[model samples]
Target: MTELLPAAGLTLADEILLAERLNEFVQDREAFSDNTWKQLLSVMRTGSRWASEHGRSFLPMSRADLRDYLLWLQASGRASSTVSTHAALISMLHRNAGLVPPNISPLVFRAVKKINRTAVISGERAGQAIPFRIGDLLRLDAQWSGSGRLQQVRDLAFLHVAYATLLRVSELGRLRVRDISRTADGRIVLDVAWTKTIVMTGGLIKALSDLSSQRLTEWITLSGLIAEPDAFLFGPVHRSNRATVALLNPLSTRALEDIFARAWREAGPGKDARPNKNRYRGWSGHSTRVGAAIDMALKKYSTAQIMQEGTWKKPETVMRYIRHVDAHAGAMVDLMDKYASS
Candidate 1:
């Protein structure tokens, strides 16, 4: 469950080997439910893909091939922030392997800059997209309105908890009934055990609105899971009497993406408005997080406060969520109000 930095004494090959071992550790734990191993595998596969074409016979990689690989990632639709994470993984692999020389030189620095710039330009700086918005939620609720009471309640609960908590899809999917609790002031708070940036310490968030909480309560009561606090909150709702264990697993990443796609289709202008295969699209699963941040920013939440609430470790992380359109609109309103005739 804990993320470890690469060891100092490791070589490039050793780093790769250790990464594989760590992945096995994660798979064996079974305590965690997210796709940590899958994401790490993705990074390793990316390294392999580039290393195949760009690596020298004796060297783990070539500078020119590295540059070209970065360019390929950028053009192939990897986000700037994600690309940077991948770059960090790669750089760590090298540095931990003692690939760099002790004496710094301009040439070495420039080569480092080349790789870093590739990450920056790949949309790595843009960070992850936020979750869905209110408008999008309404559209989704409407789309699945006729399914049934349980399905309706479940859909609303998914959207509400996700947006209200700004939870990653894995956290949302893995949520248990006991994970949520009420504070002294009657405000709802969530005790998120696992997230992208956490190992143990939990964060708190005040109730932004009441509708989400109500939907959550309704889903719990209606789903007959109040007795099974430790069990998955969302799971197969319409299973037959003899359904197997494998048939009723909680939501998967692809399922969540498909849900987002359906909502987006209805929210957008046409069938082509479907949000997929792109990071910074008109909408996606993370749009809820993005929309929540935008909502907070418009309400005058400082970047520092926003970062804390969003559980981001850095201010630049918060900046990445502040989309250009929102920035321009805020600036425009300020200017128009200041210069307008009384």
Candidate 2:
């Protein structure tokens, strides 16, 4: 590991002190989830590569070096959020290396602020997944429910459970056969034992709708996952339409996104009473979560209830999904609907 900064002024004793800090950073990484560790390493390599491009090394990077790196990212058309993540991760690396974090500087802060403002002014907003509302689910269920390929049936079930529980794609892919249980009266209850939000606490149990349970049962029966309770619930549906226990590994997050997008698009446009409001494009696994929250809002469910169901840690996050709906139902909209129409 290269020194984070010039060690010219430090004595040998100071080097020993710094070694302790470096050890702490190294040991702490051992506890990160595999996905997290991969991300951190990737970012670190990217930062180093960017530094090499400018004829410098990343470890001893200064605040100015970081600001330049961020500017380069902006110039290369990275999203503001991506720029923010890079800046944050680079800063954390610096801190853990016993150097001052570049993000602590006013210059670095101004650079990030500029990137954010530029994105907003240029309409370079991050695209949110089109909400997969209950109506879309109905249409998709209609289209994909019958004697389809093993993959198609699995996806139908995936979309249903995803919308009902608002589970992130990672959580959905992490689901195990053991996580599912049926009540004596035949109601299906899913125990979500692995979610990013509730990592510190134990998992929560979510109830599936009768329709969703039926779809899932079909997939489980088709895939033959019932025999292996310890295996992951979902796997790649091969060309032969068989997903045996031997073929069991959790679906990759990208694979899950592609699966959701496929089913959502294949179902075609939904039929809503509202004109020009059909959402049939650009759906992702996240659409299920967003759609679930929006549906709950339309049904007049409280924010707390929505958050509880979605396992969202922040009120502001879940509200961002339904704020447009709130705007539409405002007092002015009421006036426009009742008086202006007449």
Q: Whose lDDT is greatest here?
A: 2
Query: In model 2, which runs have C-alpha deviations exceeding 4 angstroms?
Result: 1-27, 33-35, 246-248, 270-281, 331-342
TM-score of each: 0.68, 0.84
Q: Candidate 1: which stretches are off by over 4 Å?
A: 1-37, 53-83, 95-131, 135-147, 183-188, 201-208, 239-249, 265-282, 325-342
Q: What C-alpha RMSD separates each model from the true structure?
A: 6.2, 4.6
Q: For candidate 2, list the clashing residue pairs, or say none.
A: none
Error of 1 at 163 (Å): 1.3
As for model 2, its CA RMSD to the true structure in angstroms is 4.6
- Per residue, candidate 2 scores C-alpha lDDT tens digits across 1-342 of 644544234577666766788788888885666666677788888888988878865765777888999999999988898899888888777778776677888999999999999989998755566777899889888888886688889888888888888988888888888889998867689988767667655668999988988999988888888887888888777888787563346778888888876864586454432222233356776888898899999899999999999989899998788888777778888998999779
Clashes of each: 19, 0
For candidate 1, what is the total of clashing residue pairs?
19
Best-fitting candidate, scored by TM-score: 2
Q: Cα RMSD (Å) between model 1 and the true structure?
A: 6.2
